[model samples]
Target: MRVNADFTKRVAVHFDRNDWIASPAAGVERKMLDRIGEEVARATTIVRFAPGSAFAAHTHDGGEEYLVLDGVFQDETGDFPAGSYVRNPPTSSHTPSAKEGATILVKLHQFDPEDRTEIRRSITGDSNLQLFKDSREDVRVLNLSPGEKLDLDAVDGLELFVIAGSVQESDEEFSVWDWLRLPPGARSTALAGAEGARIWIKSGHLSQMI
Candidate 1:
């Protein structure tokens, strides 16, 4: 059950919201971008929880990072609305539900054991690009305007998810919910299109996975 499991190659791909398929969970679905192993796997996915749907409690042996795209997502911690970014470190457990529905971009089992910091952020903050991991600036979010470009210099690996607006790089035009991953030495300069773009970037972790 592997999808785009190669960690050594550079990949530049895009998927629309409608490209998703149903998940095993009733009232839920997924658009899987990358995966390794089975149910409990190293994966990156866009999960949509139907109204009044919930998932059973589960433990994150590796870690989990997620961003709410729309609607409200709830857990034991709190209710997270759109524009919320959250990270749950290794060994974290929770039961997730969305009373009104929600679409979220989530990454599972993708954190280093040493990276045990838990963070939650809302879009209301003035810090457009806030670093979740201290010192190295590995994981963060960015708010961009039309015609703006983010240069990637000496990045060993990179992952970008367009949360809003249209984003472009070379010939790839990405609207909301599009994700792109690049391996070591790959060029991934993101340029915003007409409506501008807000993106989540995970840099320097792919090539150095722990």
Candidate 2:
């Protein structure tokens, strides 16, 4: 059940080229970026919930993190609109759904076993936002101006998702919702397009996992 499972290679997934696969839950679907395991696995994905759809209550034994891309995501704790970021560390439980449909980028089973801190916030209108940082990884969201260049170092592996606009790396261009992963020790640069770009980045984590 592995997709882009090689930790030593670079991988890129463009939004327009990937197909949505239906999830076990009704009216829910996912675009798997990387996966390693069965149902409950170490994975990165884009999930979409149809209106009135919900997933069964579940506990995250290995942790869960997500950023709402559109619409509203709701649970017993509260309702989260687009641009919201949430981290439910190990042992957290919740029933998640979207009353009006929603899209989110999520990472699962990727947290340190000792991490139990919870974070929930909105990142709207931010030029740059640091979501989290630990010895294992650094997570951030950045908004770029037109034709801007972003230098990235992958000393311990780096991953980025294009949330809006387009970015070019080497000879390849990434549009909205695209994802890219670089192996440890790699270095790359991304140049924004005419409309600029908004991206989420996570680095220094793969070495710990691999």
Candidate 3:
């Protein structure tokens, strides 16, 4: 029940290449990425809900983070449309359903017990992105053109996923749904392809023990 459970090694996968498997819920399918348990597992997956689909009420023991990739994702708490980022902290409960269908990237049980920050970001056009540069670190998330590179700090690691368009790192070409995890101190660079790129990039978690 473990996939990429080791913290020392890097794990990368192209979710688009994986087979879609049905979940227990009707009309809901998933592309499981990394999992570490049974039904209520610590997992990361891409879930697609057919129109009128619903999932029974459930509780997340650790936490849940999700980004709406397309359509609308809804729960008792609120409705999250495409481009929405959400985090339900540990010990949360909800019943999720979709009226017009939807797809989402979901991560479960990957939270730091003390890190209770919840975030919701809607990254549509006209959003003003703030950038900061220091001697040792530079962090930014905005419209990135081809050949633009981000240099993550040496103390932490970089995790990059191509949310839209394509990106090339070394000789590896990653399209939508492709994820790359770089180990601590790993030096890597990426370039957006012809269509340019919009990505969700996160760093500063390399020291976390899995």
Which candidate has the highest lDDT of all? 2
Please give the range of 10 consecutive residues that has the lowest summed lDDT in model 3: 130-139
* Model 1: how far residue 107 lies from native, Å: 0.5
For residue 114, what is the lDDT in candidate 2? 93
TM-score of 3: 0.86
lDDT agreement with native, every candidate: 0.81, 0.93, 0.74
Q: How does each model score on TM-score? A: 0.91, 0.97, 0.86
> Which tens-of-lDDT digit does each residue in 3-97 have in candidate 2?
99999999999877999999999999999999999889999999999999999999999999999999999999999999899999999999999
Off by over 4 Å in 2: none
Query: What's the residue-level lDDT of 184 in candidate 1?
Result: 72
Better of 1 and 3 by TM-score: 1
User: lDDT by residue for model 1 over 85-155, one digit each (tens)?
Assistant: 89999999999999999989899997877777898888644357765765444777788889998886526
Q: Pick the winner on TM-score between candidates 2 and 3.
A: 2
For candidate 2, the lDDT comes to 0.93
Best by TM-score: 2
Q: List the candidate numbers ranked by TM-score, top first.
A: 2, 1, 3
How much is the lDDT of residue 73 in candidate 1?
95
